[model samples]
Target: MDRWVGKTAVVTGASSGIGSGIAVGFANAGINVIGLARRTEPIEVLKSQVTGSGSITAHHCDVSSAEDVAATFKWINETFGCVHILVNNAGIFVTGGITDAGDDMISENDIIAILDTNLKGTILCARHAIASMRSNNFDGHVININSIAGHYVPMSSKFNVYTSSKYGVTGFTAGLLNELADHKNKIKVTSVSPGLVNTSLNVVAATTTDMPALRPKDIADACLYVLSTPPTVNINELTITPVTERRL
Candidate 1:
């Protein structure tokens, strides 16, 4: 932890939920955090509220958009040389079911939106963030915010393509490991799969989900733990679920 006092970290989907929590945690750790999301207002509010040694700067970027993602990374490279960490946490979920329809139905665009943000966004962020690591010879880390949904499908979760997208993320993490190894890069890639988090992402149905759920800060703690490990250690995958969380 002391070794990364003034480094830069880019956290996507920092507007709310787990994303914002991780951004706050990093800022408190004296790491300059660049928060990217479609809506930057919440991030701005969070930045103002935090009293920490590090700072949080919000940027408007739809991770699904190639132009937005590319531009955001370009700005990061100029503003903060060679990112030391990147949290690919931006994601979306269309409420209802896979075949849901009639206002509650998941449309084609909705499917694209979910997959684009959850899957493609992760890939793009990883691709760009590692570029800096290679350029600066910085042994950085890329943390992908995955879900238990990716590994196992729970009953009546009403999640359709969301699970598939996360499954893709699980695969992406594995593939990324090989990509780095092939390139002979030391940058670490970790997939943190959390289960049933009590987060209000504004995407999931606004129900009072009373089931046992993990907090966003819990996920943040897991990420810090991953970072705190000696450089010789590389956590391939970390799955976190509440004690009472049911495993389907």
Candidate 2:
């Protein structure tokens, strides 16, 4: 945390839920935070509310759009010069299963949306952020806010291609790590996968379950720990589940 003071961090999906929590946590730790989200109003509200040595600047970005992402990073570079940390946390889900037919089936557009936002978006942001880190000759860190579904598919049918998108994230994180290692890059990557969290992402499960569920801030705390580690140490993956979670 001390090492990161006055440094810059980029947090995607910062309008709400886990992304918002992580943005707040990092800013409070004295790191200048650039909050990116499609909906800028919430982030703008948060900017005014943040109280600490650091601050949050809201930027409108749709991670699924390469143009938007590129423009946002360009603005960040012009404003902050370098990105010390990046959190790829933007994601979305819609109701449908792969095997369903007719009206019950997930539409092609929805499938594309899931893949674009969850998988492609992560890659795009990381690509740009890594470029910034390399060009500036700064040792940077990337933390992907993955899900338990990234590790193993749950028994529920509601997830549909959501699980597939997350699985892609799991693979992408590993592949990126190998690529970085081959180049002997000082850039570190981590995947923080959590079981059912009590965010808009898991609202139904959170309400229906009598068992324990993780909160948005819980994931934030986990990420903070990962960021606070020694530069030489890279946590490959961290899977956190509430005590009562039944999944593996």
Candidate 3:
């Protein structure tokens, strides 16, 4: 489907995992993709893996920093003319309980860090994307990569910060959707909450005891489905969890 042909998308955290998968998916569908991440090497590899039929540019930017995000978006607008899609996927999962095991206690700094990177970063990107889109009268879409934990925190005994941050993202998306609706805007907003994807985010952690986790591509597919929808239809929320995982 060349529905994305001539369109430009900016995907955060595109160096690996779900971000990389989403970037590839957009590229395959003929959308010019600008991938943003702190690491340059992995994004370079991702750029090479794209179908080559669409343009892919990698930019090194830490989404946690507003300055970096602003600068990167400036470059994107200058090069691509206008961005039609923005995927806020850059996030960090810091596993820790409210109280307990070795190095497992959630610190004040940990909570702040998670909020800064996930919630604030998402708002920062969305703010810039919206500004650019509105200025250009570009009807665009914003997809926030949330988690099932955002709705129901499984094993609340572990990963408190991560869950809270995700919940904030879900709430933010919901509110933003309503606000856009009130304005009668064409900018589509949706949140995709996936459960236990097999990505580096959970590779070193033992918080989840479940096996057969969902693949990063699964979440990417969800994003594509949201993007492919008609402007009149809005997929407010989508959750992708492994069928066998009762915890999700």
Candidate 4:
């Protein structure tokens, strides 16, 4: 934590949910945090509420768009210097059976939307983040906000494509790790996968304690734990689930 104070961190999907939690958590610890999302209102609110050694700034970025991502990263470099931490927490779930005949649930647009944000968005962010680290000669951390679906598919409807995207994340994380190791880059990439997080992303709204779920702050804490580790330690993958979560 001392190593990151006064440094920069970027968190996507910061308007709400996990993204917001991560941004606030980092900012609370005296790290200058930039929360990027399509909507800046929520992040602006968060910026106002953050009371800690560090500060929070709100930036608008639609991670799915390459142009938006590029511009956002450019702004980060120019305004904040280098990004010490990038939390790819922006994601969305499209509810519709794969067999959606009416094209309401699983349409072509839905598929593209999910992949663009869940997969391509992460790749784009990582690309720029790596570039930032390389140019600055800084050893940084890339913490991906993945889901349990990345590891396994559960018995559920309307989650097939979402699960597929998560699996892509799993594969991508490993690939990125290999790339970093091959280059001998001190940069660390970690995947924090949580099961049934209690966020608005879930259509069912699992607010009851009886349901197995994790809070956004819990995931944020995991990110902090990873970042807090020694630079020599790289937590390649961390899977978290509520005690009530049953194994399939």
Candidate 5:
């Protein structure tokens, strides 16, 4: 569907994985995609792969930092005029047992860092996007990339901080949705939780068995589907998981 034709989208963590997939997907659908990440290399690669003539502007910014996020959003607004959609997909995973793991394991510092990046970073981006949307008198959406871990405790190794942060994201999304509901179909907020995606975030060297995993494109497809829906419809939450994994 060309639902995104002539629209502008901002995708965080667009350098790789799910973010890259989403950016490219939007571009293919005729949307102008603004790819934001700490690194510019992967975004450049993504820009080259876009099928249509739609544009892809790569911006370097660390989503975890408020300063960077604000600056990047400002740049996006000035450059693109209006941000029709925002995909908050920037995040990190540092897994380890709460008690057994060493300093590198989810330490106090790691917990703070994870929370800062996943939760606070998401908030920062959403805040800026909301302000811009309100000021421009434009209706837009904020899509957070959550995980199955946010809803259920995994049988796998410890992921204390990651889990907490994701749960925070879910909660934030719910709250934002409620607040935007008053807009009477203008603004929307939603979260997509996927299980075991094959990405660099899953530190394979530290994990045990390798199980079936979803591809980044799968999450991208979900995002596109959500965006394609009419403003009258709101997809509050969506979970994507591999069928082989018995756990819900």
Candidate 6:
């Protein structure tokens, strides 16, 4: 934690929920945080609330767009010179299974939305962030906000696409570790997989079940713990779930 103080961190989907929590946590730890999301207003509010040695700057970025991602990284490099951390937290979930619509089937747009943001967006951010770290010869950490679904299906068929996308993340994390190893890079990659969380993102599940859900801050704490470890220690994957919830 002391080593990370005064460093730069980028947190995607920082407008609300887990992303916002992580951004706030990092800032309070004296890490300058750049929060990216399509909605910058909430992040702006968050920036105003920071009272610490660190700060937060809101940037409008749609991770699904390569141009947007590229521009944001360019700004980070030009302004901060290097990024020490990246939290790939942007994601989306849409209802309806493959055969839900019967003759019509699931919406193609829904599938695209999930994969573009969940899988593709994660890849794009890691790509640019790692590039920045390498070019600067700085060892950095990449943390993907994964889900327990990435390991196994916990619910029904409606979440098929979402689960599949996270599964891709699980695989991506391993692949990235191998790639970094091959290059003898000191950079670290971690997948912080959380179970059901008590956020608007999980309102549907919350209202329908008595099972407890973890809070956004819980996930934030997990991330902080991961980042605080010594450079020699790389947490490959972490899974957290509510106490009452059975392991999926």
TM-score of 1: 0.94
Tens digits of lDDT, candidate 4, 1-248: 79998999999999998889888888888899999999999998887667788888998999999999999999999988898889998998988777756565577888899999999999999999989988999999999999888988876665758888899889999999999999989999999998878888876334335667788888888888988899889999999887867753
Model 2 score (lDDT): 0.90
* Model 5 stretches with alpha carbons more than 4 Å out: 1-3, 100-104, 183-185, 204-210
Candidate 6 residues lying further than 4 Å off, grouped into runs, are: 101-105
lDDT preference between candidates 1 and 5, better one: 1
RMSD of each: 2.1, 1.5, 2.0, 1.8, 2.1, 1.6
What TM-score number comes out for model 2? 0.96
Better of 1 and 6 by TM-score: 6
In terms of lDDT, model 5 sits at 0.83
User: Quick one: best TM-score, which candidate?
Assistant: 2
- The per-model lDDT (C-alpha) reads 0.87, 0.90, 0.84, 0.88, 0.83, 0.91
Sort all candidates by TM-score, best to worst.
2, 6, 4, 1, 3, 5
User: Candidate 3 has which clashing residue pairs, if any?
Assistant: none
Show model 1 residue runs off by greater than 4 Å. Answer: 100-104, 202-210
Worst 10 residues of 3 by lDDT: 203-212
Q: In candidate 2, how many Å is residue 27 off?
A: 0.8
Write candidate 1's Cα lDDT for 1-248 as tens digits: 88777899999999999999999998888888999988989999888656678889999999998888899899999988878999999998767667635446678988899999999999998999999888888999999999888887766456788899999999999999998889888899999999878787533324535557788999989999999989888999999988876664
Can you give the lDDT of residue 18 in candidate 1?
A: 96
Tens digits of per-residue lDDT for model 6, 195-239 = 889877784465558767888889989998998899899999999
Task: Write down the TM-score of every candidate.
Answer: 0.94, 0.96, 0.92, 0.95, 0.92, 0.95
